[model samples]
Target: MRENLTSVSSLNMAFTDSMKPTDLSADKKGIKRKNWRRRIGFLLKTNSSQPILRLVKNRSYRPSVDDVNQWAQSLDKLLGHKYGKAAFHIFLKSEFCEENIEFWTACEDFKKLTSRKDLVSKANSIHEEFIRSEAAKEINLDFHTKNAIVQSLHAPTPTSFLAAQKKVYSLMENNSYPRFINSDLYKELCAAAKGEGKHIKS
Candidate 1:
């Protein structure tokens, strides 16, 4: 159990509070603060969700209203968006279940390898880190899926981890995804996106 974003309540507060406009504008410090806010606002208003880091331009990233709304619609929509995926990852880390997403992402990356050598190496690494009996970040898997992955590792193919990956994805979708949707972190994000003033820092 690593200390995740939510575990640091103060940092989480700082991130959510970053969305609100600062109460300064009379002195040089105030002027600088306003400029910083403007720059960050500009970045958030961009069409793409590329800048989803909670630390916007150093200390924050605000998802647009659309982004937040779509996340609530389905797990697919949430994971499909880069910002959504990043936010979910942070949420999962807080829950100490980040291995699910991590393994899924590794499987996705593994599928893109063209060379057999690269596939074999990555396959073995992913297995040792995640699929082995006592892996570093072992994920929940049925005995059948686990053994299947072990067997496939010797002559790894792009889909070698497909079943295991699907299982992990299903676990997140059924368990963590719902919790994430109803989490304080998510509520704060929604508030920031919908609130008059918006920003984030962590």
Candidate 2:
């Protein structure tokens, strides 16, 4: 939902107008356009919790051709992956923007992550970091758990499901999850996991 780069579109032109070579503001700042064809590109980072809110450093996050493809694929994966979409729906409520190219920043920082066909590998990195932080009590009970569920969106087996279950249970145990678990999205996932008809909000 949150964008790391500003997409330039004219009122009279197609959205296909590529993102111009301009410094994506990490915050509120002026813009200077550059010749994109000559610019070297780096990558923008995202993860499980606020995956849509990618934070790119000034002049550092220029995206590689492959990374751009992967990031776009990541967006699609979030929409299709059950748990990822579910959790991200909630994130969207808090972060979605009208324009796809608005400058955005994630709520968390990542030290290292892997590259997957889409954003799955990046999401896994965030998930493992959250679990580690929670185990060490480095993160508060709320965020630690929320991110864990987001990671479970890529669940391919029972192990990943159980991992998400552990975090959800911890939330219930601490009595800090009423807002999160009671949401329409969470309940939808809960029902679908139980083989009920309702999985997505109508």
Please name the candidate that would achieve the greatest TM-score relative to the true structure.
1
State the displacement of the C-alpha of residue 5, model 1, in Å, after optimal TM-score superposition. 8.0
Model 2 stretches with alpha carbons more than 4 Å out: 1-109, 113-177, 198-202
Give candidate 2's error at residue 80 in angstroms: 18
Task: Write one digit per residue (lDDT tens) for candidate 1, span 81-170.
Answer: 877786677666555577888899899899999999999999999988998888878998999999998888889999999988888888
* RMSD of each candidate relative to the true structure: 10.4, 17.7
Best-fitting candidate, measured by lDDT?
1
Ten-residue region with minimum lDDT total, candidate 1: 14-23
Clashes of each: 7, 4
Predictions in order: lDDT: 0.69, 0.31
Q: Lowest summed-lDDT stretch of 10 residues in model 2?
A: 98-107
Clashing pairs in 1: 15-201, 19-199, 55-59, 55-60, 56-59, 56-60, 60-200
lDDT by residue (tens digit), candidate 2, 12-71:
111112232333455312221121111111111122222222333232222233432332
TM-score per candidate, chains pooled: 0.71, 0.21
